[model samples]
Target: MSSDAPVGARPPAGKTFFGHPRALSTLFLTEMWERFSFYGMRAILVLYLTAAVADGGLDLGESSANAVYGTYNAMVYLMALPGGWVADRLIGARRSVLWGGVVIAAGHYVMAIPTGWSVFAGMALIVLGTGLLKPNISTMVGDLYERDSPRRDAGFSIFYMGINLGAFIAPLITGFLGERINWHLGFGAAAVGMTFGVLQYVLGRRNLGDAGARPADPLLGADRRRALTRIGVATVILLAVLLVLLVAGWFTVDTVVNLLTVVTVLVTVGYFARILTDREISGTERSRMKAYVWLFLFAASFWLIYDQAGSVLNIFAADRTDRSLGGFTFPASWLQSVNPILIIIGAPLAAALWLKLGHRVSTPTKFAVGLVLNGLSFVLMAAAAQAAVGGDLVSPLWLVAVYAIQVAGELSLSPVGLSATTKLAPVKYASQMLGLWFLATAVGDAIGGQVARLADTWSQPVYFLTFGLASVVLGLAAVMFTRQIRHLMAGIH
Candidate 1:
């Protein structure tokens, strides 16, 4: 009903691209540029934080840097709750995407301004921007395809590849600029990427016009006006309260920030459960949503270990690994590119492997395999930690191997989960459902950051081994529940 077409009707011809709507390209490039900005900033984030005070960093100790890392990563996902809600109820996906791009561009530009407050302001803006863009973009992709279209999975796969392509290359360019020249230059480059995305989207509006139309209502303009009025008042009150809290200092910076984060997560989860209980969602749809919850748990577990590429692993590369190769010093920031590079190489092969085995294996079973593989990546990391403790430089091969394994794990679950979201989600609350999917990732990353902090408390080997063991246990338990979860997917395929 939200679509441009009448119920059960089809679009006109000449809009097809590789078996999907041509608009997929517009969405693809839009996501590509957005991710380029995001990952470009991500590549330099830890290095910027952990750099010595003389080099323009805050001179924060390892603990402070990792804590900020955790908090920042958590907030990126947390913001998606309101982002999804705003798109569903008011702005629609097109406007939300545009607004998110503007905010992100401004955030990156703010980081280029060169001040301590600029860093805080930039981070807040990026968090809000990502929440707005990330979920809405993917939901728009699903909207381009009709329900039960076989091309839907492949479309998501293609879109996901665009994400990796941006992620893979951004770090190499931005990381080099940040490390070799100026950190702000790298941030400036990210701003340019976002700006380009925004411009492309506005120019290509016709291609995406059908993808994010406002929902139709019998009351028409009256309904629209009432909704806008309500949202405007809510926004004004929320901003005023936040400004007051900041002035009063009744909440310390960290406490108030994290408290707002907790409130966001709880409210989002409650909304999704309410949807699950609604009469509009059929019994099969509820079962599939429940299955999604399990998949969410599985994903959260993987990210808990996987997100360390930025924090704990960044530390390992900087402090323990020898960057020397003959007379050349490898830039520490460049090391962040390893996982994305591996994703580029391994994602295709993993997809092929899944295609070969998909008929024989269920999705939950494949997800279990992904968890086990992810755990093994950390087992290798633990071995690297052991080598470091003994004063031996870890072979770069160990890092490459770990990255390869993690990418393999990612390929197993990431595309499957994206496709499952579209299949399982009821058409009415499509963006909201995907928002919950992303919220799971946010929760996972937050918990992972906390777990990554264990490296600061105990020995690195203990931290690594504990995560590995937890993955193995959770993976097996997930495998045990596969039959029940698969029952939920009965009508979806």
Candidate 2:
């Protein structure tokens, strides 16, 4: 099984990049284009829906549009689990990446058509493709290095740069085409990007060698039969439910998005219950698990707000923020670039802060600060809303300031949370713990989508204040319990 082998263990054959496997470039380029397409479509999705009918938009109601947008984004998150399952149990990661890219390109092309059906159909395809691609690509990234290789971290860091680079560039190009010119053309551009990604992936396939060439876990004949039977049953059940609800006129896209939110929360709860009750776990492991539980909550809360950068914030940027600078105007999609830019600048400073402090600050404390900062960003948003009440475009700097604060919150939480998860994971349940951690983002995005569906009905001030106060309260609660959580961590941090 590929799982037993260290990724990228084979010696380089033909070429290399930065002293690592040449395959890194293939995987890197593939992921870059994938993100480019994803964020590109995302940058314009809300804007397109809200634009006037004369402007080639759907001219949908704000509530309906926001709901669909949230649900599409949430579906992308919700599919990751099943996607990973399929990759590990059915096919290899290599094939998964290839097929996922193909599907993604097709999805983009579907969205390029100027029709109602194309909109929903395109989202569905992208969701499925992203699920397949997201987890497996990172897995292949790890596979590109031998076990404990120093080059491993550097390799991943470099690959992640591809992600940031793609995300940063996507909005500028696609946003301009979609918002300022033609929406279909913008989507067509995404298809071209993904098409290029698939082509490059094919060209570089050999560089991967045996990594992810086979599933880590293969189902035996009987097990495969049982699994298929269960899947069939589940599919039948889902369709039946969908049919009934659709006929009843209660199965709108927003309803589906909200249902996914419930599913995410339930799944996370089930995971925590399973680990805490497992008899095989050690006493110390159990304590660490308790600490993880709180950390998970705080992290989820932070993301619930931060993930709005794409949905709510994107909308705000397009309709509310002033994008002009002395006669030069910019696309709203360019606002998305602020996050990666800030992350790039602040990452080293954040690392230095931790290093200089050197254990003086506890893990839980750092998380709490992040949550508080997350809340503050929303407060700033609330202020921006207040300023815009008179029907004038708010300054772009308002959004930038909000992002700057949230990025600090992000840097403090994201890396530290991952590290803490690794330390706290029980040996037997290590992989599951990691899965649970990823679940946090899925859950956050799910909830964020649900909240964003309210963009129409809720007053801007009320909406921002509600979430802002909730985040601050959660952050303060985390801070209050920091000592107790530290005790439970049993010194893992």
Local distance difference test, candidate 2: 0.83
Which number leads on TM-score? Answer: 2
Question: How do the residues 1-493 of candidate 1 rate in per-residue lDDT, one tens digit apiece?
Answer: 1222223333323576677787888788889999899889887887787788778776656665675777688788878877776776667667888889999999999998877677778988998888888877876776776766777778877887788778877887888788778888888888998899889888877876466654222224788688778879988998888888778886454455466546646765786678788998777778787888788889878877888787888778777888888988776666777877777677778778878876687778878988998999898898889989967777666777888888888888876776677678876776456566666677777666556656878888888888887897888888999888888876554
TM per candidate: 0.87, 0.94
- State the lDDT at 55 in candidate 2: 93
lDDT tens string, model 2, 39-104? 888888888877788999988776667666766766786677677777778887778888889999
lDDT, residue 278, candidate 2: 93
TM-score of 2: 0.94
**Candidate with the greatest lDDT versus the true structure:** 2
